[model samples]
Target chain A: SQTIHQWPATLVQPVGSPLSLECTVEGTSNPNLYWYRQAAGRGLQLLFYSVGIGQISSEVPQNLSASRPQDRQFILSSKKLLLSDSGFYLCAWSEASAVYEQYFGPGTRLTVT
Target chain B: AQSVSQHNHHVILSEAASLELGCNYSYGGTVNLFWYVQYPGQHLQLLLKYFSGDPLVKGIKGFEAEFIKSKFSFNLRKPSVQWSDTAEYFCALSTLVNFNKFYFGSGTKLNVKP
Candidate 1:
């Protein structure tokens, strides 16, 4: 079975500080990786998605960026964080063949103070 | 703009009560619909999905959703609710034209009282 891992489970970062969240999938290769931010009432907002290594498609313009260094490793980074960047960040993966159904990781709770 | 709408933002119901959460989409073309559940302090899990074939789809935990093409709606239903069913439900839509991007509704929070 495939499993997705994300860390740190919770994060507290200061404003203007750098941010980095990692997501790695085990038992799957060349999977479609996605980054989403979910608010309290608002649903998930897709921030970025990567089809392959070094290929990232951004859904919305924001203070965050994504990179797929390896086939199963995806990273979300920001040079400077903002207060609005605080939210529950989710990392999801779908099989490249059937990309409709997605599996989510435990998620990272980042609070920018 | 193309979007997914979930009418109910919050709902409270007792155990054994029925559930019907509405989900609608405004996009035209070949689209795929999905319902996901997020239990308290847990990651989102796929409840059910509708790609084709049966208009009525059964998902995990005795939950089901029906897709009405004419109305562009995929409403989730449950015959009886349980306190463990207290969670946030989200409706999502994706199309072949968009390639891996999914539009999500505002989500409906269901609080099942014991």
Candidate 2:
């Protein structure tokens, strides 16, 4: 069975602060990872996706960035956060062979004050 | 451009009631379809998916969906829904050439009362 872990489950950050969210997957290797953000009452917006280590594609250029430091480890970071960055961030993984069905993590709820 | 549309933004039903959520996609080429469910405070889970072969796909929790190629629609159905079925449902689509980028619908919030 494959499992994805993300943390911290919830965070409260002040405006203009830095941000870091981590996601790790177990029981799978060389999986494609993705980062998505959902604003309140809105659908998900794809931020970034990584095919392999050090390879990332940005869907929307914004204040956030994603990195695949390891085969199973993905990180979302921002040097300085904005108030618009407050939302629920989800990390997902899909097998390289069948990449259509994506498995999502519990998600990180970030509140910018 | 590929996009997915979920017809209902929100639906309320009683337990044991039938369920049918509409999903339509706009894509010309061969594409894969999927229905995902996100229970309150839980991650999105695959309820059903359509890749090839059979147009009718059955998924977890006694849920099913039919793919109509001509209509370009994949509507999810359940004979009887429970209170536990209250959650947000999302329809997604991916083309063969752009499989990495999955387009999602706005989602439908289904509330099943006891």
Candidate 3:
């Protein structure tokens, strides 16, 4: 069975602080990774996606950026956080054969104050 | 505007009541459809998916959805609802043109009353 793990289930960060969220998948290889942000009353927004290591695509350009450092490890980082950056962040993985079907992680709740 | 649209933002239903949630997409060409559920305090999980073959697909938890190609609509249905069904439902679509990208609708919050 495949499992996706995200760190810092919940975090509270002050404005102008740096942000880092990690996501790693197990039991799968060469999986496509995605980063999404979900806000109240708003649907999930795709922030970035990666097909392979060091390859990243930005869906919605903002202050956030994503990097695939390893085959199974993905990192979302920001030099300085904004109040609008606070939301529920989700990490998802899909097999290359079936990119349409995705498996999501438990998600990280970051509150920027 | 969102490419995918979920008409129901919030719904309150009693146990045993029938469920029908409307989902519409604005993309053309071959597309894959999916329905996901997020129970309170839990990760989002796929309820059902439609790639091809049957237009009507059955998902877990006694839920089903019918895809109407002409209408560009894939509506979710449930014969009877339960208290445990109270959760958030999201409708998503991915086109073959960009299989790696998915567009999600504004989720519908279902509150099932006991």
lDDT of 1 by residue, A1-113 (tens): 99999999999999999999999999988999999999988999999999899999988889999999899999999999999999999999998887769999999999999
- Candidate 1 per-residue lDDT, tens place, B10-51, comes to 999999999999999998898899999999988899999999
Name the best candidate (by DockQ): 3
Expressed as tens digits, the lDDT of each residue in B1-114 for candidate 3 is: 338999899999999999999999998799899999999999999999999999999999999999999999999999999999999999999988889998999999999999
lDDT of 3: 0.94
Give me the runs in candidate 2 sitting further than 4 Å from their true place.
none
Residues B39-85 of candidate 2 have per-residue lDDT tens digits of: 99888999999999999999999999999999999999999999999
Recovered native contacts in candidate 2, as a fraction?
0.57
TM-score of chain B of each: 0.98, 0.99, 0.97
Q: RMSD (Cα, Å) of candidate 1?
A: 0.9
Task: Provide the lowest-lDDT 10-residue window in model 2 chain B.
Answer: B1-10
Q: What is the lDDT ranking, best to worst?
A: 1, 3, 2
Per-model DockQ against the true two-chain complex: 0.81, 0.72, 0.86
Q: Candidate 1, residue A69: CA error in Å?
A: 0.9
Q: Give residue A95's lDDT in candidate 1 (0 to 100).
A: 89
True-structure RMSD, every candidate: 0.9, 1.1, 1.0
Worst 10 residues of 1 chain A by lDDT: A94-103
